[model samples]
Target: MKTIKSILGILVAALFVNTAIAGTPSAKKATTLAVDTKESKIHWLAKKVTGQHEGTIAISSGSLITSGAKVTGGSFVIDMKSIVCTDITDAEYNKKFIGHITTGDFFEVEKFPTTTFKITKVAGSNITGDLTLHGVTKSITFPAKITVAGGKTTATASIPVDRTEFNVRYGSKKFFESIGDKAIDDVFTLDVTLVAGK
Candidate 1:
């Protein structure tokens, strides 16, 4: 009788342990974010002999990592083929110049179709990362204001990058000639606003 009672008690305890272990919740998966391309915009300006031309760059789909309340640095890849500069005035002339930009001269889009930014650290509203452009990777830190509201996230950041650093030397001389040796500024400011839906 004693042996049977002990065995029964041990089985009950084992069953309870098994049940408790099975009921425990697992770790949540990382939240994936989608870049709102329609709401997002990228533009650049260059001085010409006459005036300045402005254009937009297109962003493709990418992912961002986030925990429950914190944003883990993620990667963003930009599409280089979608560069548009409508201020050229002449349609044919603009098309020819754009084609050249896609080649080795400007972006080298064929060899490197995408420019990637990998976030390495996040400090308050400042983000530090490595930005790869024109086959060269450089460490860059920029002020990024990140906001999370009602399960939706929005981040805005601005960074000034030198065109010469990326080997983008088009219209430098002509633009400088127009502006008295200071035509186009080497540093072009990039304003990025990214929205993500949880």
Candidate 2:
């Protein structure tokens, strides 16, 4: 009778252990969300001694990696050829201006056609990324507002980039001297809005 009671207690304890193991949940894995190219937008603002030019640029492709509601990583490819000056209305002058920028003077679109930004770290409201532009890559940190909800993520940031760091030295006063009114500001701003979904 005593042996049987001991055997029954051991079996019950084993069963309880198995049940607890089976009820434990597994760890959740990270998910990749593809960027919605149609909904995402990147606007660029460049300044010179005279005035500023605001334009829109297209994203070629990208994706964001997320774990639960937090954004982990992402990258974006900018289509250099899609640059358009929204503030310029004259067709002839617009064409000339675009040509001047796309040619050897600035950007040199013929040689380096695309730009890319890859996220390295995201902490709080700050994002650090490696920006590859004009055949050069540089790591930059900027503040951004990011939100994840309902299987989608939206991010917006106003990033200021010094064009001279990427070898775009056209009319920058940092490189050229005595060019008072013709000198362009080295820093250009990029206002980006990225939308991604699973």
The segments of candidate 1 whose C-alpha lies over 4 angstroms from its true place after superposition are 1-30, 47-51, 170-184
Query: In model 2, what lDDT does residue 152 have?
Result: 80
Q: How many residue pairs clash per model?
A: 0, 0
lDDT of each: 0.75, 0.92
Weakest ten-residue segment in model 1 by summed lDDT: 174-183
Clashing pairs in 2: none
lDDT of 2 by residue, 94-132 (tens): 999999989888899889999999999999889999999
Model 1 gets an lDDT of 0.75
Per lDDT, the best of the predicted structures is 2
Candidate 2 local distance difference test against the native:
0.92
Error of 2 at 93 (Å): 0.4
lDDT of 1 by residue, 1-198 (tens): 999999999999999999999999887667888777776666666553456666888777655677765677777778878888867889899999798778866778988888878889988778888888888888899888778887777777777777677777655663445556445555666667777774
What candidate 2 gets wrong by more than 4 Å, as runs, is 1-26
Tell me the TM-score of model 2: 0.86
